[model samples]
Target: MSARTFLRIAVSNTLVKNIARYVMMMLLALLLFGIILLATGKDPFQSYRDMFGATFGSAYGFSEVLVAMIPMLITALAVALPSRVGLINVGGEGQLYIGAAFATWGALTFKDQPAWVLLPLMALLGMIGGALWAFIPGYLKSIGLVNETITTLLMNSIAPKIVGFLIFGFWHSPMDTVKTENFVSAARLPTFFNTRVHLGFVIALVLLALFWIIMKYTRWGLEMRAIGGNPQAARRNGIPLKGYLIVIMCLGGAIAGLAGMSHVSGFYGVLILNFSMGLGFMGFLICWLAGGDPIGIFLMSFVVAIITTGGNFLQLTQGLPYAVINILLALALFVVLASPKFFEGKKA
Candidate 1:
């Protein structure tokens, strides 16, 4: 092909188009958010510079960004997996909470165990806890008794309360009424190179890779994609739709539980009451923005993590409210929603 033709062909490629669309959405979102900043009498350019510089200026700042990203990466997968089968799992928060609770129980009960023994046991317990919590909603959905979205969303509210009760009544530390004691060295996820970034970052990346592989190559992936495309058609093909529904939802929960486990074990080293600051919801937003693409999930999660870390910097440096980040995120989401066709490549 001629050079010009090659360039046009490359630009027209599906992957290239999707990437370009995401870039456009982000630019548009930033522009809109900048206007909002201007309207509020803030220096938008300076604010942008400060945010990016604070996040990228030092190795420590960048490591913190990764620390923030790990949870969202895992949680976004929690939402993304169920989505592949036409299931909407909005309870990643609850799943994460229940998972952490389970891991905490294991960590306390087996506090003296060696790292090799305790870590895997805690991870298994965390997965089981999240899966069980997710199962209630999954079962309800499978039998057509209720929608997964509503059940999962309602459960998100319940999970934290249950954690709160456990903390106050059974797991509280001597120094705090609303948090558990710090976990032993065995229970804590190993950190990297003296930075806050933990093993969860590796775990999240592995799960994301696994997700891509399963969805792209496996028979189950094929079936799930069929179901998502047309449920009635998939059912007619003897795909065992109900079983997939229940299993996949539970699996998604298991992943979310891992996120919870990582947060406590790696990030906090203690279970605190209401520790999650809408992580599940944020994951949901990332999944929506990425439209269930693995690469998109990673990119969007990183973008969000940068924004989140920058929000902290903005508060200290520019005297802006941390809540401003939410407004930016909302604008981005709105832009994506309003221009769905752009991402969908509808015209092409």
Candidate 2:
């Protein structure tokens, strides 16, 4: 056979296999979800209808879904970027909390400043906070051979405790709430068309586009991908592994910090304990589902947002437990990890 013909055949087979794998994963997840519903004496079809209707049936529902997608998109990029350099960054949760705290501090300290000044200042502080939190893990990994996953996860636990202490002690209001005072008007992110959908949504989209370009065309991105593919080869090529690891990890943390700031500035306008609501972890799943493709991350983040928004309807109307939504998400991750056979081409 000719070389060109063999190459074409190989590419076609690979494409077909990938398509089959994705379809199988989806089908398996749905099947498992249906089984759970049946075991609980509920109709899966009706539940699905309710879920979809609540998320997409009205403009308002769709708007809420978009609101939910903003932070997910940013935080997903946090995970995806570092993953390209063969690093697992699980500390987005901690980074996010610290980011929010720093942003809140800026807002409170500069309450009388103009929007142009205060907003940017808050964002910078948030990024710095997140990057610092991420840097510790990166530095330890580079210097002491510590596992980034464990350090980052441990940081996640520590960040909330710090926030709790601040809100419950120093920043606490006499109103008996564990949340800080509301941010000034100038500190709040602007909305689009006077809707609840804030500027953070647009920011997430811009970051997605920016990262896509960087990953596809930039030299740095190429180096990161090479390192991910083979560390020994990257080292042989004279790539500075330690420097790249720390830089990429810090960049990821900065993105997650932006997510935290967005949540406070655009959604809550106040710093509260546990305000993240597991969005950082959801971002991890988004990265896994997207396979580290920026565009795929954008699309999958929205899909997860739909599920989250729909889950609220499941609770309010159908009286279903919120755990059902968690089960659905877990099933999705399971199927993606378990269905590799569909991606395998026929052997000779």
Best by TM-score: 1
Residue ranges of candidate 2 with Cα displaced over 4 Å = 1-24, 340-348
lDDT string for model 1 (6-32, tens) is 688567788687778878988898999
Count of clashing pairs, candidate 2:
0
**Against the true structure, whose lDDT is highest?**
1
278: Cα error in model 2, Å? 1.6
| Model 2 local distance difference test score | 0.84
TM-score of each: 0.92, 0.88
Residue lDDT tens for model 2, 1-348: 589986896688666666566667767877898899889888888888888898889888889899989989999888988988888998889999999999999998899999999999999999998999999999998775799999999999999999999888888666856888888899999987656899999888899898878876899878888888887799799999889889989988988998999999999998988888788888987786777676567767776787778888888877888867888777877876664343242100
* Model 2, residue pairs in steric clash: none
User: How much is 100 displaced in model 2, in angstroms?
Assistant: 1.0
Candidate 1's C-alpha runs over 4 A off are: 1-12, 342-348
Per-prediction count of colliding residue pairs?
0, 0
